[model samples]
Target: MSSTLKVGILGYGYATATFHAPLINAVPGLKLVAISSSNATKVHADWPQLQVCSTPEELIARTDIDLVVIPTPNETHHALAVKALTAGKHVVVDKPFTLDTAEAHDLIAHADAAQKLLSVFHNRRWVADFLTVQKLLASGQLGRITHFESHFDRFRPEVRQRWREGAGLGSGLWYDLGPHLLDQAICLFGMPQTIYVDRVLQRDGALADDWFHAVLGYGELRMILHASMLVAHESPRFIIHGTKGSYTKEGIDPQEDALKAGVRPDAKDWGVDETMGRLDVMRGTWMQHSQVANERGDYTRYYAAIRDAILHGAPNPVPATEALQVMQLLEAGMLSAREGRLIRLHH
Candidate 1:
């Protein structure tokens, strides 16, 4: 059963094209059997060997498919995942697990009942910069974290026609980038005490939100998640501070760009951030500043973990429950933004 984990993807959009397909094909035990896509030409061009189905129904129902990956629009995740899980196939839903926390809970219950593995594609947790921070925080080098900031900003002047930019529950910068930032926060610090958000359509004539700034409060420690389309000079990926020192990291993870450029995930020195982070730590009584060496951020680690969980029963890399917490934080942000008030998370 080593090579019997045939995986079927539920969409051929950017997420599937750039991330899921490439990463699935890269892993050893996972085989790309079929894909759900309307664009046969583009799908064929991307993978001539793989079978392309017109709809997700055809792909998820295949007897040979052991795993089903849904990288479709955020709104359709719950429905597709339910169908796949009920079909007795392991399910992988992309981030922002579902449009709402209720939908996420239902999916989790369905997956648990089906006894099939359910996971989310929370790939940002594998970033090299984040890994470094994890090491620092775990080592107690950053004593009593006071503030942490994570940004996923970009400069998109013209809001191209896309489902994410359209008017919907899962559309907007908050839904798009919020999951990534929040997942990272939850990984380090569990649920926050309060959530505050400021969401607006900053871009001229933009339909949905083009920018968002959220604050996750944990007593004295506050985590900031910010993203925008109008940022010409993108901010650092992470800005972290504690009682000991501050770590300001610049540059996004190279894996996504490398995938878009047709570079293999296992290429020479993959996931290595060329531009390292500036580390300021208290040495004795004074603070010393230096460049911290970055750990290689390999996204394939996620797929590998999935394979192990399916075949060898290893723990899931991004379990459904962890993704659920991210969903809860997202909903809290929405409530905060809608009411123009700070939403306190009891747990």
Candidate 2:
């Protein structure tokens, strides 16, 4: 293997163009070498030097590529990742790792058999608000958190003609944004004991579910994860209440917006979020409120860790096992919604 891991992305869609390619290129020990896209011109318009393959199979078969990043649709992740792993390349699949836990397990097994690293792009873990929440929790300022609510709501009333909003197997708000919220929650609190979900199609012409509310129970703690397409008002991105205090944050991470605006990940203020979170805690006699500065988010760290894991045997940043757990929760959430009952997790 070369000192730099050559990467080939499986698609040229929004995720591939917005997050994966730019992040891979920004990392030091990784190279965005090739991309499989039908429209080579579109890929070349941004990365003129990249090798654009006509098909994912061709890209996976390349002898020079050491890593294949699958940022394609949720349904295609399993098959493409399997092919890449079988071809002896490290694989990174965008989140909602696969449609279900079964596919996630299959991919993990394939990577193990091929002696390759497998990772999922749960990049929200590096978001500024989430990072701040981690620090605040670790500091024990919130005491023992009893209630946590996370929202990824948007105001898109009109449904678009995209695969993500289609009635396909893996198309819905739950599969689209559920992985991110679930992964972040799981990171803060381990796997929940039970999960209950309510999924709905709120948009007028929506074919897939556009809104979802999920509740994950952890003993006495109740964690709520919600996303909707019809919310116009400002909603707290994160709200946590503990025995000693409470914390509330507003606004989503800025990295995605920056990336969408063609901002390079190497910029000085790459992941700097200006929105401060309000931390209210009891200090002796009275309650005090203070603004907590956010920690800088760096999605490039994920790819960099992937580079080190492949070349230097460092731990995988977002290992297949961790993502598989997220998949389990996603599947369980669906079952809960379908059966209208709380689903219990075994492990």
Candidate 3:
């Protein structure tokens, strides 16, 4: 419970650049003390003052580091997280937690055994559009959600030569974007009663699935989760319909793009995108719409929560168990897609 918690970040790829660095820099009581990356050139160029290592093991072995942020490839999350927890360091692993629920459970077991704080970086839950949706729902504007559709589409026709675009256990859009969208849905409306899925590899040379459409059955409510790589244009990120009215918002969160361009988390226009999403509603016989500015997405909160949880006994913002639930949903989605059957969830 030191006043300044020293932190170490693993990997310097997209996750590290777009999330770990900026957010770590923004949070109080958390100092970016060290980093581990095979190619530390880029990270060193960005933060020259920190101690840079060549491996995660070396980083976590250092007693000076109290917290470790794992932003490695999807296949490595479970292993790295378990290792960090065993090293007596609080850990933050990026989603989707693991390839399956078994691996997630194993990591959870290790974390619990070590009595370490483990959390997942489900940053999409803090997206401006999601926050806006929360506001709308809290206002009781979209009464008793009957139908909901959320899309996390992209227009990358050609599969880049990366782990994510390959045919591996944790590759593809299902593993890459599934956790973000699904976890947000789970947070808003508890786990769905049942799930049905449809998945496809639209591109010619694509080795992994690039398109997926999942339907979550909640009695009278049907929630659709969609993601595709070949979409030349994307649909609204959120579309909700209820008994009283409907809300439609089209646009993606700006934080990712901001962090990519070396924009620090504390920038004045940090989460601002001129093309912010708009909400359209249809109530009774009248149609009403307003372009509400997307709420400011504060990634800083994740680190802040971690600091408080580790130092002040506050609850972990994205608990390891909550992440396991997301992994369960992802596994169920994949299983349902392959078997062409609906998955009946247990509690």
lDDT of each: 0.90, 0.93, 0.85
User: For residues 1-347, could you state the per-residue lDDT of candidate 2 as single tens digits?
Assistant: 87989999998999998999989998998888899999999999999999999999999999999999999988899999988999999999999899988898899899999999999999998889999999999999889999999999889999998899999989999999999999999999999999999999888999999999999999999999999999899799999999999999999999999999999987889899999999899999999999999999999889889999999999999999999999999999999999999999999
Predicted model with the maximum lDDT:
2
Candidate No. with top TM-score = 2
For candidate 1, the per-residue lDDT at 265 reads 84
- Each candidate structure's TM-score, on Cα atoms with residue i matched to residue i, is 0.98, 0.99, 0.95
Backbone clash count, each prediction separately: 0, 0, 0
For model 3, give the 10-residue run with minimal summed lDDT: 272-281
lDDT of 1 by residue, 1-347 (tens): 55558899998999999999999998998899999888888999989998999999999889989999999999999999999999999999998899998999999999999999999999988878889889878888768899899888888989889999999769988889989989988899999999999999988779899889999889999899999898888579888898998889888888899999999887997899878888889999998999888888989899999999999999999999999899998998999999999998876
Mark the regions of model 1 whose C-alpha exceeds 4 Å error after superposition.
Answer: none
Per-residue lDDT tens digits for candidate 3, residues 1-347, read 57999999998887787778779978889899988987778887888888889988999899999999988888888888888998899888888887788998898899889998989999888778888888888888767889999999889988789888899779988888888888988888889999998888999899998998999988899999999987777578888899877777787888887787778887898766555555556667887777777677777877888899999999999998999889889988888988999999997
Q: Candidate 1 has what TM-score?
A: 0.98
